[model samples]
Target: MLILGCMVLIAGCGCLGLWFAYRIRRRPQELRECSMALALLDTEIVWGATPLPEAFGILKERTDVPWQGFFGELKERLSQGESAGIAWKETMIAQNSHFCLKSEDWNVIGDVGKGLGRSDRTEQHKQIELVQRQLMVIKEQAETWSGKQAKMWSYLGFLGGIAGVLILI
Candidate 1:
């Protein structure tokens, strides 16, 4: 029973470690996805000449979770007569907890929200492109950190579990 208990404890610790590593690993990918999604939005607004709410509808169809949900909610809000900036801000706030991005990334995203529906297509595209550039820079940083730390976190988690079990024993 003691050995079994130790095994369970070790497994739990290892899982916790893996979870940390998973979050670290997910950050860059999520940021990349965000950048891509923005590109799509730029195309929709700038070239396709779609309205904000319709652009969001198109975007939600093409995106994955978090972004998909975000765009969908934006569409709904806009359809319900919410203002563009307000809808974007509220949707971002509601969906931020679901993303793996850092504060810097969130701030960049917020910049995009600020320009939505408040300007012409050219200006909106410029804002989105700026945010995309910022997101890429941040994504590069996140990738670098993820590469350096993800494995360390995973190994540390398992090792830390073993250490805990040994200490307890």
Candidate 2:
């Protein structure tokens, strides 16, 4: 019974590690998806010269949750007559919990809104491109760090649990 209990504890610890690792693994994909959404926004801006709300509406359809939610919120805000920049910031703050992004990532995203209605087409394109690049950088960072640490986290959890069981024994 003691041995069985130890094994169960160890398994639980290992599962915790795996869960952490799995969350880490998903971060890169989330950033990549954000990058894609930005790209879609850029396309709408450059080719269609689409208005901010309509561009975000298009993105809301092309993206997944959290992203779709973010864009949808922006569209809703715009429809309500909020300024584009203000809507962007408000939606970002409101939907922040839904993303895996860090504070730095949020700052980068905030920068994307700085030139919304104030900028020329060329400048808007540049801002979108810049944000897209930043997102790609974050995605690369997540992929690199996860590649190194995810297995380590899993192994450490398994080993730490085993050690704990041994100490108890």
Candidate 3:
């Protein structure tokens, strides 16, 4: 029973490490998806001449999770009479913990919120493009870090679990 308990504990710790690794690996993908979602928003707003709420509603339908949820929340907030910037900030604040994105990424996103519905279509397009560029750079950095650190985290987790088991024994 003692050995069994130790084994289970080690396995659980190892799984926790794997979860961390997975999160790291997912960060770059999430950033890239965010950039793409911004491009979609740009299209909806600039080319299609859609209103902020309607554009966000379109984004909510077309994007993936986190983004899908983000856009949906933004749409709902826009309906509640909040400005785009405030709604965006609140949404980011509320959902920040659930995402793998860092503060800088959120800042980049915040820029978009600040610009939304504040300027003409051309200016909005420029702001969205700037954000997309920033996100691409951040995504590249995240990819590099993920490639190196993801494996490290997984290994460290497993080793830490082994160390804990040894200490317990």
User: What local lDDT does model 1 show for residue 64?
Assistant: 91
Any runs in candidate 2 off by more than 4 Å, and if so which? Answer: none
Expressed as tens digits, the lDDT of each residue in 96-142 for candidate 2 is 98887678878988988888877888899999899988888888888
Rank candidates, lDDT, best first. Answer: 3, 1, 2
lDDT of 3 by residue, 1-169 (tens): 9988888888988999999999999899999989988999999888999999999999999888888888899999999999998999999998888799888889988999888888999999999999999999999999999999899989988898899999988
Steric overlap count per candidate: 0, 0, 0
In model 1, which runs have C-alpha deviations exceeding 4 angstroms? none
Each model's TM-score, in the order given?
0.96, 0.88, 0.97
lDDT (Cα, tens digit) per residue for candidate 1, span 6-105: 8898899889989989989999998998899899999999899998889999989999987899999999999999998899889888888998777777
What's the lDDT for all of these models? 0.90, 0.87, 0.91
Q: Note each model's CA RMSD in angstroms.
A: 1.0, 1.9, 0.9
C-alpha-based local distance difference test score of model 2: 0.87
Error of 1 at 146 (Å): 0.7
The 10-residue segment of model 1 with minimum total lDDT is 99-108
